[model samples]
Target: MELVFKTEDAISKLLTIKIEYFDSLQIYLLNDLWVHEMEGDFFLKEVESFKPILKRQLKYGLNPEEYINKVCKRIKEKLEFLEEHKVGSIEFLQFYCKQIKPITEITTFPSLGTDFYDEFKTSLKECKTDETDLYKFLVRFAEGNFNYTKYHEFSIGCLSYVIWNYYCALTELYRFVSTLQENAPFVDFSNLDIEDNKKCTEHLKTDIKVHFNQDKISVAHLFLFLLKEKHIVFDCKDERNNELQLKRFIEAHLTYLNINGDRVPIRSFNREFSEARASTKVQKHKQFINKFIYGLEQYRDSLKD
Candidate 1:
């Protein structure tokens, strides 16, 4: 007797596993969000949850062939379900993968594709040891209390977008490193304990923390790393911007109400948020809030100097 698996079925299965992987990441983020609210330890809370799952997955012993087969099967099922619904699972997956569209459908920054390589080269050329340069901030970010594993999840979330929206060319990632090497000594990322790093390998987790926080890093440096390695752009703003904008608007509105003696009794802030969210022109309202708050902040800052 002979055993054989159909390739299409294999792909579907893999995608299903990938979807599950994404779901696990979502759960992690949700937990982190809860922790953030409670001012709790994010990494410790996650490890408390992760160890049990890891034990269960490892119970059957190392079976790469079986594991791979199972993953492929799951992915295929998901794709089929999407196909039946007349939605490109690929397209839907792309949107979901990027943290942006899932949160709000406001803007679509075109995936950099190969142009990212050019931007990276240009950025690296302009890199200097500036304390405030965005690239420096990124390096500092890498070295800071970023929780690389969570950062990895964030990266994966971004990658889902990259795979779904941009060209699914994996080679572009490796090529990015070659480009970086052209300049100077870049981080030896191979030492990093990313998803596939073997057990007992010397991981870069501690070192990443130590170096990144020591000095302000360059945004250009960070951009190159993300673009080449992670396929994400830091300044390709989306969800974070939206949130900031909404926050600004609400603060400004409160200030105005206080000044005008409008007699609008301060009610539940949550209720107001709900109402604003329910509005048809939510984006416009959000923008209005953002602008007012930003302008007010700027005006205040200006007064000092």
Candidate 2:
């Protein structure tokens, strides 16, 4: 009984399980409207409670009313509007489905095709440390060549953003890593016990009081090490490598190659992102969308990509 206070409440963890339900609902709502033909109480039963619980779950920081307005009210109004204008026919159903298309409808980033993502993952799987200058710097830094310290802060900052949207990725990855129990056959954790073993691993900054072991794939360095094997330049260069630049480069070579035209928000191409003359109006629109998709990329690039 004494060890009980040291643990998170069982009900909190149970509530955490509800996050998957809310996450799927949010993703479904992203490209779809509440234009479904269903029982009248669907909103009350399926969605109304989700807002309150999810808001609490996320510890929502801004626009406290956003979930209520965009999700709860948006669906409520849509259902009412649709009910008043309800029409029944083959074309109407098709149109309804079309209007509420899922992002998965494309099956992949449009220009990138379905296989590019798979290929990219394969590339990542094949990556190794010897291929990266940063890895070499890390190695020598470990070996007592202190010059690596000169680039320490700069490198960590660059590495942080290299995997674009990693903060969100970590949320998803946490689900996987948390399920990894002690002494898993594949998990070679010599130093996994360092610190609390429950906090984020830092690459630098001694004050953080947490770090990852070599076997920690969750560490950004190992991920970057894998990325390096494919010659994908994610190293945060002094002023040359921005997220958009790397994104465009990857899209061009991996996604848009042999496709004969750039695409939008999902798939795009440009061997070089900064070359201002090489884009169409759609490309320009997508540039805006991509900037919006990961605005941090643009802001950071502006600062010193």
Candidate 3:
């Protein structure tokens, strides 16, 4: 008898397992940081806890170079450990899964699809039965066949999907730490002249309000358009890229408004500027485009006078 399996069901189950594993791992790592007040998302909490330390070091005239190197070294050590024990072992997986809280929904399984499923299934069948308990468990769970020794032989197969999820989480954590290090010097705790800063802030706000502020055009979209039009350029030599600098400026202004009794969620920016610019090229925004062009022409006519 030929055996058939619903790949979607298997994939969905695996995806759920992966998500649960990652969620548990995040909580574990966060707890390791000894953070008491968990206010926001994982990344935000990480930044909140980490930023102050860097600031404090700089304020005290301590060399942050040694501290950053130590942190990176620790992260690298963890990465190496994770790499070595990612697969061919089920102890870590079992430990993490024990802390897994039930999730209400599983919406995203990035980079996992039909191709991944095919490769996973083929690898499972090829793995040796005595290689590890993980392989034995997977085979039994997937096929529901206890007589696997009589039915088939297994060899060491593809890296377990669960390990892939853990590796990705760790890798992102490393990148976030690296970014914080790179942007450390940009964090200013001293008082500086506010006149120029105020002008730049107001200019950005007015441009957004006048030209690009629409229900359909997000701040991210506007910034993206400006970037493409060469209205803004990222200076490679700067500690923070132009995008980060702009984001901080806009967010600071929003915070000031909020403090003055304006209720607003922080604006989010992303790389969807191309879509916004493309939308303007269509007939839907033709009138808006024409108005902008006419304004420019009027400015030129006034200059002629």
Candidate 4:
């Protein structure tokens, strides 16, 4: 985090993280994140504490009024630009999220369907992690009926002081990515400045291609599998309604990666996923993928012990 503010790309990175964090927080709100095993008061209280600390740090490191004004103004303009381009309202996005709920919900059915996202499941198996058994993790997510490892008080808590807001943002962003949103354009690239525009355009461009690496694909599959598993048990009918578990799931994954010294393949996974979302012509979805991935990359890069 200190490095982010000291680098030449500070402002760009700040804007990037700000937007990314915004998407994560918004997604958290959208999914009613607190309902998923987190104490509502505790979670909300934690989030509420971030802004003041961030503001003080920004003011200390930047021209108090100028940088503050610039950041706030840019965010407002970017959001306005998105709105003008017909990015759907939060309510609409939530509706879209709800519409996809059935695919996962059926996993809890008395007889699991034959065609239950097998491709996603296969992706998980392909990505072998020495640190943790992803197969068992995926199965745990699918079942969503067990007392899970408690990470908030441990591994996640062991992360650096700079990680609180970022952890909140990145985890929530992953939740949204797993569920996916409607196929609609989520950003307006034309209105952005050259550098930012290129950043946006690069995400949407299909001209450039890379050789698909199996490890990368496998990592993506694991994330996708975890995400789908969450949806299946995200909302339940009985006492387990909105069964809280994604946070713990992510904490466990991060712990494994940290212990094994593995670069969280989240960056590549997000790029591939972002490209796919960009292709869907949903500006809002693209905007989210881009921003969330940016923030997530920063978070992962800062994970030094």
TM-score winner = 3
Q: Which stretches of candidate 1 lie over 4 Å from their true place?
A: 1-37, 42-44, 59-305
After best superposition, candidate 1 residue 67: deviation in angstroms?
3.4
Stretches of model 3 off by over 4 angstroms after superposition = 1-18, 21-46, 56-62, 65-222, 236-266, 271-274, 277-289, 298-304
Which of 3 and 4 is ahead in TM-score? 3
- lDDT tens digits, residue span 1-305, model 2: 32232121322232221101012222222112221112223322322333234333223233323322333333323323322232111222233444443333423221211242243234435653353433332342232322222333223222221211222222222222222221223333332333242332222112222222221111222223234454555446622333333432333233221223332221222212322222453455345445444866767778953
Error of 4 at 42 (Å): 7.2
lDDT of 3: 0.38
lDDT of 4 at 171: 38
lDDT for position 183 in model 4: 10
Instruction: Put down candidate 3 lDDT per residue, 165-202, tens digits, no spaces.
Output: 33444444444444445544554423222333222111
Single out the weakest 10-residue window by summed lDDT for candidate 4: 153-162
Instruction: Encode model 4's per-residue lDDT on 1-305: one tens digit a residue.
Output: 57335432433432232211112111122122221223323323443343343334333454333444454444434433332332222222233343322121211212111132243345445753333322232332333332223322111111111222333343333232222121113433233223231232223323222322234433334444445456445445532213223222333333223333554423213233333334454554445457657978999999997
Question: What is the C-alpha lDDT profile of model 1 across 1-305, one tens digit per residue?
Answer: 01123333322232331222223223222211211122223223332333233223323234423543454334334433433332312344445454332222213233222343344335545663443222332333333333223434334333332222111111121122212222213333233323332221232222111122111112122222334343653334664433322322222232223333343322112223333444574665456556556978999988954
State the C-alpha lDDT per candidate.
Answer: 0.31, 0.29, 0.38, 0.33
Candidate 4: how large is its RMSD? 22.5
RMSD of 1: 22.3
Worst 10 residues of 3 by lDDT: 150-159
Ranking by lDDT: 3, 4, 1, 2
